[model samples]
Target: MESLLDISKAEKKNKLYDSITPNRFKRTIIKDWQLYVLCAPVIIYFLIFEFGPMYGVQLAFKDFIIGKGIWGSPWVGFKHFERFFTSYQFNIILRNTLVLSIYSLAAGFPFPVILAIMLNNIRGERFKKIVQTTTYAPHFISVVVFCGMINIFLSPSTGIVNFFIKQLRLEPIFFMGKASMFSHIFVWSDIWQNTGWAAIVYIAALSGINPELYEAAKIDGANKLKSIWHVDLPGIMPTIITLLIMRIGKILSLGFQKAYLLQTPLNIDASEIIATYTYKVGLLDAQYSYSTAIGLFNTVVNILLLIMANQLSKKFNDVSLW
Candidate 1:
């Protein structure tokens, strides 16, 4: 009898909790209605522009005839993917993309952090602002304009770079025309263009760090370098790791614009990346299904990399996107 009564009481309590939940939810909605209204446009934008086009990903699996709509098209499964994998250009494209992306990441990743730290240590406000403005101005230049500037500046006969070489009696080199020079030019130019803008995030992170930590480090007889090493680095490590993980996740996603603009017949071996190839095949060559499969593969790889990086970050540093 006691057991029966306990069971009946438990059921009644559960029933009461369930009955209260909807009322509580309704009250919350009433209180937060304005916040929800503010969020509605962003939510709607993502649903329409981002999530809506996901339906077209089906083109990757189908032969995709325009006459036969998406649902009407017959599926070829992994045929296009297999063809891409087996193609002769596969190795070359993948190699060039990986090399450029990895080189860019390795060369460009630390400069922003270094810049931010250096700027943080600056004692003169006026001088610091001048340096910041000088560095940041390049980021505002359009990519096409930047590429044009590169071409003009690197021209063998007429460019300033070659003018210096001529003074030294050395042969003028075509920087953009050489396959080996392509990665260097791309990486260094990008670093010069974007480092200051990228450092803003790190600078913001550094600003949020407690000033008392620096004082404590000085009290402990630590010098400026030691203080930075002990306090500044540890304080901003989470930001660094988060950014690093994001960069790693996009290992294969090199920008097509600058690469395409800088590409010449001589440097095509080093510059034909996945993005440019996809654009050519998909839009220019009219191989819609094939290009879709390549894009899907690229996306799938990026997603896997993101998951892997997140997991590794969580395990090692206890910081992750999740």
Candidate 2:
């Protein structure tokens, strides 16, 4: 009986192996030919444009020389990372990155939500359209042009802001040159540029909210603010959570373009961030490997923050990216 059972088990294992074996690629193509065809271009694009370039990440671990190329370079693992960590500029750059990101996240994140709520509450369609159009126009303005306008508008000698200061018997302040004003100017400019554009997504989410919920809240004698707090906010909480998670994921990243464009020599102490640091190192200094290491570090931190935020959101509110 024992011998028979052993033979039977061997046969069963062979049968299972046979059942699992097949021309998997052909079978998959046959099963979802159209879907595969549709995704082929996107898959190919990412493979070429995204994953292909990922090979260069090895530069971060190498003592890269232009003549030697990335693959031919001498291995110097963690040297650049150590240099960046111990450098005198490390704390300054890290502090600027954290403080600016936090300020932007705290101040810029809610403007869109508030704008969406207000715009949704508008009784007049024409008025709402006008407001949205006026607000969104700024988003399309080129960064250089926008910063130029800001400089012109804030110029101490002749600018409108300084003129107002003069009228109020206050000494003229050069807003651009003030380090203390850098984060506020960056955040408010971001809000002004992006608030209305961001509102479109929140407004779309709000539209999907059931009108019956509002009606029920109204019947229960809830005022406009109370109804919004109870019904509208709850309805949009998922959207809010998702956006908040995305915001947290970008907590260390501020786009280099606007900040770089707006940064003056006087404000460089406060405006220098990881992105700008990378740009200067890679582009200006031509220290490709060191810059890549810094970039890789930034990416890892962003990923970690994203995971942490998602976990916290799930535990606290039962809302998560996954």
Candidate 3:
């Protein structure tokens, strides 16, 4: 009976080996060794810099005494969140962040698509590259330098904008100093700076579309505009929808550098956003616990927004990040 049982176990082991991959995971690694080697550095970087610090996230709910350390700090539960939620400036900060993001999104979204579509229609290669280069140049400028240029160009005393207004016999208005004008300037400037680069992806999508559709449309008596309406728009709609979902996911995370650089006593109300507020609270005031809590809240909201946006995209267009 013992000999028969040993034979049975040997047969089962052989069957298992036969059913699986020849060398299992080892074979895969050996076959794609170069690809794995290439990806190793990125995985290491994320593990070290991106995910390693997650251990300290608990400080958000702790008193965070430097001497006591994050683990030894006293847990205070939702105290910090309660403070932020009940603060007088909560609504104001939220409003400012949303308004800037929405304004930029609404204005910035369509311009790239329009630019790509129009550029696709251009038959002259030289003129198209010239236009693309001119638009793309602004995106290379540093945030600090870009903001400084804005200040100089919008200066009421000697700005070219004011020079033209003075030529028209009108008073030189201080554009940057006005709260109401901040959103418009920020949105329009973002559009001008990023439209060309953003259009690159859409243009790539348009290129992948079958040229035969355009020829068919042309043969059916469709004009230039009509051809684009029938062929180009539908072909690139997936890319547009995908990009829009990403934009919506990041709706609240406006860039901190530009907002901080552009901030002033005059435009503070409009320019004050969660990113700048988090910076000031965390680094400047040294309220590490409070700042961490606020940051965690921001991250949670962003995740929720991303999930919601993904769901909506999936529902409408059957495309999603998940």
Worst 10 residues of 2 by lDDT: 19-28
Write model 1 residue lDDT over 73-105, tens digit each, in one string: 899999999999999988999999999999999
lDDT of 2 at 204: 92
lDDT by residue for model 3 over 194-301, one digit each (tens)?
999899999999999899999999999999999999999999999999999999899888789988888888988888899999899899999999989888988899
Candidate 1: worst-modelled 10 consecutive residues by lDDT: 15-24
Q: How well is each residue in 1-322 modelled by candidate 2, as lDDT tens digits? A: 9999999999988766665657654665688899989999999999999998799999989988888887999999899999999998889989999998998888888888899898877799999999988988988999999898888988999899999999999999999898888888888888888899988888999999999988999999999999889987888889999989998998887789888988899998899999999999999999999999999999999999999999999998999888
lDDT of 3 at 58: 92
CA shift at 33, candidate 3, in angstroms? 7.9
- Considering only N, C-alpha and C atoms within 3 Å, which residue pairs clash in candidate 2? none
lDDT by candidate, in order shown: 0.92, 0.90, 0.90
Clashes of each: 0, 0, 0
The regions of model 1 sitting more than 4 angstroms off are 1-44
Tell how far residue 230 is off in model 2, in angstroms: 0.8
* lDDT, model 3: 0.90
Ranking by lDDT: 1, 3, 2
| Model 2: residues with Cα > 4 Å off, grouped in runs | 1-21, 30-41
